[model samples]
Target: MDQTQSSSKALTLARHVLRVEADAVAALADRLDGAFDEAVALILARRGRVIVSGIGKSGHIGRKIASTLASTGTPAYFVHPAEAIHGDLGMIQRDDALIALSNSGESAELLTIVPIIKRQGAKLIAMTGNAASSLAREADVHLDAGVTQEACPLNLAPTASTTAALALGDALAVALLDARGFSANDFARSHPGGTLGRRLLTHVRDVMRSGDDVPSVTPEASVAEAILEISRGGIGMTVVVSAERRVVGVFTDGDLRRAFAQDIDLRRARLADVMTPRPRTLAPDRLAVEAVEMMEHFKINQLPVVDDAGTLVGALNMHDLFQAKVI
Candidate 1:
């Protein structure tokens, strides 16, 4: 074929493959039945961890499922079937539950250790295309992961079948996660380096400037005094306060520019006259991400942190959220 024709054919084939794989994954939802429920129940009842095993492409999918299960409060690990035959079968315990994946339900490597797992009193859940296959028949629960066709043009590579298996694995993990009442905080604990961790685990108090670090000026002070405080605090804003240290208003660099443009004398202007009254604020215990959202919404760079009675306790700026990775 010519170069243009070859590229065109390849593009068409790629689209066709994606369509076939997508259909395979979609069909899994309709195939759900009593077996899926049984599998979930068995796993939930187990006091020990889940042992996932498979061979070849199924092994790759099994590893992902095990990882997902571990992260979502299910405590699972993948064991290569080939390795299990060599010596890794020692990892399986009597109280553990086993999930074995094989499209044909007849992989020799998996069969080698299945009997030992059963002999040890571990429950076996089989994910396979053939319900009548030996592994499915022997399993305590059989989850149907069948697909009608492969995405490969030759219909020989494991494409649609693997996709269906992977989707079913995700469904199982999510079902278990819901059953266990796993919260966002629990999920964040498993992914402390991720953005969700920063959002859920970081509070405003952890990042906000406290004590004398917060810029402040009395309402009776001059606008020039507030400007000096804002500069000294380096957060581009200063809180105007009452005698009892309750926040009355806030004066930012932006407010200074506007005041100057209006021809107001900074030296003579009182902070009360130049500051924004009752500016947007947040509680110290609130999430840093909430501060980010409020700042973005109100177009403010800094916010005074307050107590339940609206007493000024701290101060935070956009840089604080960014430094905490909440941005």
Candidate 2:
């Protein structure tokens, strides 16, 4: 074939493959019934972890499904069906539930282990394209992941069927997540190294500047002194506090500019005269992401961390959050 003709055919085939896979996933929503619900309930009621088993392409999809379930509050792990036949079958306990994936629903290795799994009292949930296959018939719950055709041009490869199975796995995980009332905080605990974990698990106290690192001046101090404190703190702002270190106001670079524009003498003006009174403050126990939201909403770059009694305990800025990777 000419280069132009070959390129045109390749593009057409790629589009066709994408359409087939998309259609397969879309069809799953319509096919979902009581079986899907039964699968979710079976997994939820199990006292032990979920064991996902498959071979070949389905094995790869099973690994991903297991990981998703594990990270989303479901205790799950993957076990290769081939390995299970040898010795890994011991991992399945009476309280655990097994999700077996096989597009054909006739995988010899899976069928070999089904009788053993049932004998041990563990429930079996089968995901297969063939509803009438032996594996589905033996399963406690059968989820139909069938597709009309493969994304492969030859109509023999597992393409669209595997996509359907993967989508069904995700649907089950999401349903279980909702049924269990799994919150974002619960998800974060399982993914402490991820961005969502950082945003949800980190608090203002973990990132804010405490003790002497916080810049503060008495309300009686001159505006010039507050400016010096701001410069020393390097956070573009300083808190104005009373005798007991309770936050009374805040003086920022913006306030300095206003003072300059109004021709007010910094050396002569008291902090109370030019500072913004009753400025927005955050509790040290608040989530760092909440601080980010508050700053973005108010268009401010700095905030004083206060205790329940309104005492200045710490301070933080946009730079602080960036350094902590909480921004």
Candidate 3:
């Protein structure tokens, strides 16, 4: 074929492959029935972790499925069928559940180990294209991950079938997540290094500038003193406090600008004269993400951290949240 024709055909083939896979996943949604519910219940009823096993492309999809389940609250791990027939079979316990992935449902390696897993009293949940295959018939719960055809032009590669199986696995995870009352905090606990974990688990105290690092000045201090404190703290603001260290107000760069706009003498103007009294504040126990929301909602960058008695404890700004990866 000519260069232009070849390029056009490649683009057309790519689009067609995407459509086929999308349709395969869409079909899985329609095919859902009591079997899907049975699969979820089977997994939920188990007291031990889930063991996922497959071969080839199914193995790749199985690993991802295991990861999704693990991160979403279900304890799961992937084991290769070949490895299972070796010494890895010891990993399967009576209390555990096995999720076996096989497009044809007749994978010799999987079939060989299915009876052994069953004999040991572990429940089998089979994900396969053939509902009546040996693996499905032997399973305690069968999940039909069938697709009409492969996305490959030759209809020989495992494209659409893998997509359908992955989507079904996601569906199972989400259903189990809801059934087990899995909350965002629970998910965050399992994924402490991710952004959602940082947002949920990180508190104001964790990111706020505490003790001497927090800039502050008494209400009696001049605007220039507050300005110097603001610059020194690098947070664009300084807290105005009483003799007891109780927060009374906050003087920010915006406050300084307003003072300049009003032609107030910075060298002589007291902080109390230009500071915002009872400014928006947050307790040190609140989430850092909440601080981001408060700052966005109030159109302010800096916040004074306070205690129950409104004592000035710390301070933080948008930069702090960003640094903590909580924004």
lDDT per model, in order?
0.94, 0.94, 0.93
Give TM per candidate: 0.94, 0.98, 0.97
Query: Which lDDT tens digits does candidate 1 get at residues 1-327?
Result: 799999999999999999999999888898798988999999999989999999999999999999999999999999999999889999999999999999999999998899999999999999999999989998999999999999998999999999999999999999999999999999999998999998899999999999999999998998778878988999999998898889999999899899989998877888888889989999999988889999999999999999998999999999988888898
Q: What TM-score does candidate 2 reach?
A: 0.98
Worst 10 residues of 2 by lDDT: 264-273
Number of clashes in model 3?
Answer: 0
Ranking under TM-score, best-scoring first?
A: 2, 3, 1
**Tens digit per residue, CA lDDT, model 3, 219-256:** 99987788789889999999999999999999998888
Candidate 2 lDDT, 1-327, residue by residue in tens? 899999999999999999999999999889899999899989988999999999999999999999999988899999999999899999999999999999999999999999999998999999999999999999999999999999998999999999999999999999999998999999999889998999999999999999999999998998778888999999999999999999999999999899899998777888888999999999999999999999999999999999999999999999999997887
Which candidate has the highest TM-score of all?
2
lDDT of 3: 0.93
lDDT of 3 at 204: 98
Task: List the RMSD of every prediction in angstroms.
Answer: 1.7, 1.0, 1.3
